[model samples]
Target: MEISKNIRESKKNILLLANKKNKGHIPSAFSIINFVYLFYENKLNINNDFILSKGHGCLALYSVLEHFNYITTEVFFSFGDFDSILGGHPHLRKNNEIKASTGSLGHGLPIAVGKALAAKINQSSKKIFCLIGDGEANEGTTWESAILADNLKLNNLICIVDNNQSQNRSIPTPNLQKKFSSFGWDVITIDGHNSNEILSVFNLNTINPLCVIMNTKKGKGIADMESNFQEWHHKGITDNLLKLYIKEIHEEAIS
Candidate 1:
């Protein structure tokens, strides 16, 4: 796999975090953890905000947040527990580093559009970076927000689509780059699992609202989960299965 230690750890962390309370969208988290981990690893400029719009992947966010000390290890461990701030979604953790309470699929982009517009109006140097799932693209709000962002000339807004295509069986969004370009966004597609590609794309300076379509597989790194991710989407992991996943991840990452 040639993945970074952070990626391996973050993947393992999500499993451990989910196994603790028998909760979490592990496959969803796995699909985007690398991006999230890299976002923190690079210590991305926070002049604005980063929204994990696909909030079912909270375990991935929490895992990297802990790794980067955005949230304490204690808080990370309290995931899905009684009286805990961490839940299956970020809507509950208003006090944490989270910028928006996301979970309801299509809301984050609209909110991001609002933030980027506000930044433009105030003449601030803030750039709003948002990560949305391919499935979330099925929502009208996603397209509406994109159109509005481009109309406003929101070069400060960067939207990254986690195009894992986990929802293709329902409604597939074919030619995402073409679609975003038609809406006036500068588009770039990349290998989502490749760290070098991830960093290169994120570093690019855009002249218009940008749409980065990161091609990825659901439940990446682990072959078993990657093959049948629908079953693992929100499944509670048994201890045996968890061990198997950990071992597989280690073998792949080390190979």
Candidate 2:
């Protein structure tokens, strides 16, 4: 669980940076932390491509990259600053490790499909992994990409839905597994925070593209924030709240 420890540390840093910069997608970011963590720690293989389709969750991705030494603490702390390249959303130029620059909802899947198709045409064995938020799924482009992925039989394409059940207005999403299954995807539903279940989906072998619907809480790992997810969706952290987050992470790190 060293990766989990690293993630906790990264979250603490992200909060501190957010407090300094006065901007962050805290709830969205925390929700997908475990998904991103397990993807890099246990699922990512050589030449594999990963797309953060849920661009608002970039803080989690940024923190994970920093944890892996792809970015420095100085660069991470500069997030959202006027002169910094790192914004609320991820930019590929800011960090080459990011496969795609995404902030517009529903675009990541199509891009991932294209990448998967290119690998298919070249007969390359690279797999394309894209993480989409349940809210992002509201876009028609997502469904279109899903259909295209199934039509192309892009077995190398894997789409993970971070079904946190809280969208722009805190509205709940539909049954993602049923929706994806209807589109001919090999769908799997699991607790998003569980690393073992998340890792197991990577082992699935099928002719169609894979879709993992991860049922997750919007603000996981932090108690007060967890219940007040809508409020913290894109809220800035205060110094007092930052202290509490640091304390919570530290407690979890040891427990």
Candidate 3:
């Protein structure tokens, strides 16, 4: 549950920044930060490669990178502007910390597939982790890459679906684990915001490629946003609302 507290604090910060920037994608960002924290903290080998397919969730990545001292708050101040390193989507060239230039939905997995194959060819110990959105699974390219990952038997590859249960237009996420399992992936489901659960599932060494479906709330941890996916997904935080959010988050974090 402390992981949830950490997640709430990070989401609160990201939400405040997003609101100030007059930008969107806060809910999506908040939903995945716990997974990011899990990987960056213990699951992932950062010396290896990671591709976040849902690049709109860059805030999640940004927060982890900052927490790890990879980047500073000054860099995030220019977010949403054309000249900033922090953009609407993640650009790999701008930050060596990021393994892929991702923004187009459904591209991370394929790119990660290539990265995984390259590592295999080079006989490198590096593994490729791809974080994708559940809604983005609708893209045909995602499934195509899944087949390749299985056919290649890329045990070096790991895919995580952030099953936030909503995307643009606030649509419900269809059952993705069954879909991936039908494609021959060794699939497991877990609570997305629970770090311990995620770590346990990832530790399981399934010789085949693995897909961990993270069942998550769209706006996890934020009171006004958690269950109200429609309004909170991209809604800007007003000055008045931000104060209330901070106070509410403090109570939740301490309680």
As for candidate 1, its clashing pairs are: none
Per residue, candidate 2 scores C-alpha lDDT tens digits across 1-255 of 676787788778778877888888988888888878767776374478889988989989888877777778788888888887778888878767788889999989999999999999999989999999998888999999989999999999999899887774655568788888999999888888777787788778778999988888786778877888877878888889888888886776321
**How many steric clashes between backbone atoms does each model show?**
0, 0, 0
lDDT (CA) for every model shown? 0.84, 0.84, 0.79
- lDDT by residue (tens digit), candidate 3, 130-191: 99988888888889998999999888888989888776465545767788888888888998
TM-score of model number 1: 0.94
TM-scores for candidates 1 onward, in order: 0.94, 0.94, 0.91
Q: Tens digits of per-residue lDDT for model 1 on 1-255?
A: 424766888788877876776878888888788888778777774555788899998888898888888788898888877777887789634544687899889988999899999999999988888999999999999999988998899998999999998886788888999999999999999888888888886678789999999988888888877999888788777899889988887765521
Deviation (Å) of 44 in candidate 2? 1.1
**All models, RMSD in angstroms:** 1.9, 1.9, 2.3
Best by TM-score: 1
Ranking by lDDT: 1, 2, 3
